[model samples]
Target: MNTETSEIQGSCHCGTVRFQVRLSEGLMTARRCDCSYCRMRGAVVVTASLRDFDLISGEEALSLYQFNTHIAKHYFCSRCGIYTHHQRRSDPHQLGINASCLNGVSPFDFEEIPVNDGVNHPSDRVSRGGSEVVGVLRFVPSNR
Candidate 1:
């Protein structure tokens, strides 16, 4: 996370779904989950208000996948088949960006951040640090 305010760009693996996000320092929030799908995908979640994200291209080239609770609508590039961002089921007002999808941002940069387990849907367990663990669908401010 850059301390200075800067714009970060991201895209799917195939370069089809391109988007930009404006981030403040410490925007990469690490969320850990033991849930089957999240664990299997190894997702580190970071989020921004819907107003902060913009789809630059490949609208037609994108595909959406939803299942189970179906609250979160996962977006991926149809061409390369990469998960880009998702409309959060818990908070439809925000978009959860896969931190791995953003360019120039490394997961190592925010490794010190705490991880919240979404496994078994532990929606009520707060971490030792006192941050609220509302649900598996948590959002961190991009301009934190």
Candidate 2:
């Protein structure tokens, strides 16, 4: 995780959705989740204050998806079918921006990303003991 802070531009796959956001802890907050939804979507997300995210364009092209508790609001491009960001269920004030959507950024950029145990989310637990790091996802590039 990196602490360098900077506002960056991002867009959906087909360029139907465009947005800019200031990462709260830069890439320091980057993480993956093992929840059912996250497991299927498979996006490396970084944290950002909802107030710091700006939807520059394609408002109508954005689609929302929520399930189960419906606290976390997942958003994506309706046209390109690419996820842009989501409002975190653990903290509504924060948005989880897909690192792949950011310009000049990719999920492969991180060699080792922490994976949260979303299957046993804190909200569902009696103690509400915060997120748990179940494991790490490492990407090793081939020399060939």
Candidate 3:
């Protein structure tokens, strides 16, 4: 919880979904998950307690998607199909903010991001926070 206390604004691709999040430590918890769905979507995520996230607007324009165990509640913009944030399956107390959706921030600013083994989550398995290390990812900013 040792972080610069700041409120950051963010929106979806179509600008329909808007939100404000209070960062506990800016991007200190930024990371990527190696789960089946996460590996394909390829979004950098940051942690925020449930009290930290606020939907500024576009609740009606939002849609939800859940798969497999269905513990993690993933949200997106119905119009823009942009991933916003999700209730972490591993830690239900935190919402995993999509780092790509944060304003004035780039995922590439970090040289390295740790990957979580979401494929074998603690909820689904007996081991809590297993020692299985997936891999680290390097964010390369796109020209466009």
Best prediction by TM-score: 2
Higher-ranked by lDDT: 2 or 3:
2
RMSD of each: 7.3, 1.5, 3.3
Q: What value of lDDT does candidate 1 attain over all alpha carbons?
A: 0.69
Model 3: per-residue lDDT, tens digit, 24-133?
67788788888889898889888898898999999999999999878899999999899999998877788989888888776776778889888777677775655255
Return the candidate ranking by lDDT, descending. Answer: 2, 3, 1
Task: Please give the range of 10 consecutive residues that has the lowest summed lDDT in model 3.
Answer: 124-133
lDDT of each: 0.69, 0.92, 0.83
Residue-by-residue lDDT tens digits, candidate 2, 66-142: 99998999999999899999999988998999999998888988998999999999888868689999999999999
Using lDDT as the measure, which candidate wins? 2
Q: Is candidate 1 or candidate 2 better by lDDT?
A: 2
Q: lDDT tens string, model 1, 1-144?
A: 563534788988888889998643336454655556766776676767778888998899989988778877888889987788888765677787877788876555553544554554433344443334444443444765
Candidate 1 Cα outliers beyond 4 Å, as residue runs: 1-6, 23-28, 122-144
TM-score of model 3 (CA atoms)? 0.87
Clashes of each: 0, 0, 0
RMSD in Å for model 1:
7.3
lDDT of 1 at 79: 92
